[model samples]
Target: MHAGSWHNRYPGESRIVLDLTSLISLYDTALAPSLVLVCAGLERCDHRVLGISSEDISRLMRKLTEVVSRPDWVGSGIDQKTLIHVIVDRYVDRLELMQHLLNFTSSDSQELLQRAKLAQAQLRVMLTPYLLHSTVVPSSDTSGVDAPHWASLMFKNCATMHTSVMINQILLMTSSEHL
Candidate 1:
């Protein structure tokens, strides 16, 4: 498979899948469908889909679960339920997905894991009111009525806003440091 070609189309998905593959190769087990659900959710937010096959998602999820289920994960304060929440929550944007996945794979620091967990919880809490006040459909058009597309738009907005905030903070810190 030409992973690079797919990468050009899907951006971060290739790396995410590769990372998951390497982790799962060490263990010989079948992958799960829930993992694909998580990846699909993230892909929907990014507005990029390279026609990911069911097999690919299954393998990726298998590796993901294996990596997260390690004994040290619990000690780090990120458990299965937290992972599920992140995966199933359609409101979770690509940045949040990337951040959580990075933490799942490379977070040796408990502080970082805790922070990631907190961020996910905060996002969920923020969505609760919207979910309650609005209908099942998200209101995205001029009509101000709810539609399904609203969720994806909201996810993109959240990711964009988070990225802008981070960039601004970095710039501020850089200027202050120079001073």
Candidate 2:
């Protein structure tokens, strides 16, 4: 599928119609996995093989930012703590995909990497409130969900992924210096 088509299909202001299952399905079936495959193919073959362009990457990033920024999951009548798992999973996949593109793509590599970093930072800012809320000790009125434990696990996963990406970036820079 063309990246432009994916961008066009993204939910807009009417995204309130999207339930959690639908949103998760969209991410699993169309968005992140497709991008990962594209990145993998780009690594193995030329862009022509997958019909992807630098422009496609930029547009996809914008669409992804829009998707992530919108709070479609807010009113979905599910436990917010459970949704954090999905959110973390999505962001981690996005970060890993960005790392692959940063390391593998030859065209506009630095520009795309900068864009990815900015996006990742923005996501972290967005997630901070939720993380803080989750880690707080719950009162008797709240469900006994052990939110702090889940939040800690999710935070650790995100930190580990970030550290790996940074290590990869440093290695790439050092190896390029030798070349």
Candidate 3:
């Protein structure tokens, strides 16, 4: 089933069982990577450097968090713990990258810095529940799978993407300085 179709199904209705693998693949290949790329490209410049407005990115980010936090994934055979872990891990990486950028940002970039800070604060508020709850009752479908290992791998990929973006940005800065 297409990922868009999942949104059309009503909650608590009898529907085809969604495969957890497809769901994870959709997130891994699409959602998480897009979010990471956008977050990585966010800069302290006056112009919209990524060709997308901050409001649009903010809306997408909010929708992503909302969808993943819903219990619907549980009924669809997804282990909520693992799903949340993957998303939260990516979010933490994004937050860290934003903080790293903010620390080096100049005073002239106050607007961008404030926006990044706000986004970080909002994400933290949204993640509070997942962070506070420590109980893990493994689902039968995912019991054998190692969620932490998966999360670690996902985090590493995001980190790698962020690193590449940062390196490119640095190179651009240096090259432009010489021009």
Candidate 4:
């Protein structure tokens, strides 16, 4: 029920959700998740975009669809798919979505462009091998892999705090050896 706080807190202020969860989950990725925290930080900032590439947008949509569909029951993480569905239905700002292609000259446009580029490059880096190898599980341990770096990927705010906590529970779950 506490869903509308950000709107009143930042009245008349435009908002954007960087959606880096889709970007971060694009591969088995082996990396521990850090992108969520970083993106959440960025989304809290005021910003705008000038031109977001279609390829990048397409990548997000694809990653969104894929991750949204494949809930990782084996690991400790949120039902990424469910959270994404909820966020898409409720919080997404259409004006921000529509103006994604503005021409960049100011700070806003540059930040948008930067976010897009980061996602685009991230997809290429993380997914290329997966596609080439045609498997979900990677060949080896990737514990040292760094999480993606971006802004605006938080799926839980005060309203969905419980869901966020559950997700962390899932991620921290592991083999009996860790216990």
For lDDT, the strongest prediction is: 2
Q: Which candidate order results from sorting by TM-score in descending order?
A: 3, 1, 2, 4
Off by over 4 Å in 4: 1-45, 71-179
What global local distance difference test value does model 3 have?
Answer: 0.55
Model 1 vs. true fold: TM: 0.26
Model 1: runs farther than 4 Å from truth? 1-149
- Predicted candidate 1 versus true structure: per-residue lDDT over 116-161, tens digit per residue: 7787776677565334334255334658555646667666665555
- The model with the greater TM-score, 1 or 4, is 1
Model with the higher TM-score, candidate 3 or 4: 3
| Residues 51-132, model 3: lDDT tens digits | 4456555666776676677664436444444444455655777668656655654556777767777777767865553442
Error of 4 at 148 (Å): 24
Candidates in order, TM-scores: namely 0.26, 0.22, 0.27, 0.21
Q: Candidate 4, residues 1-179: lDDT per residue as tens digits? A: 25766554422243543333545542222332333333443543432222434555566677657777875435435445556555454435532443453434466776877867755665565344224232234234766533332111232233455465556656787544398
Error of 2 at 44 (Å): 26
Off by over 4 Å in 2: 1-106, 133-179
Write one digit per residue (lDDT tens) for candidate 2, span 1-179: 47556654323334334344434322232334444455554443343325445555565677668768876465646444334544565478766765664554446768877877876776686566345444456575887688777667768866565455556767999999999
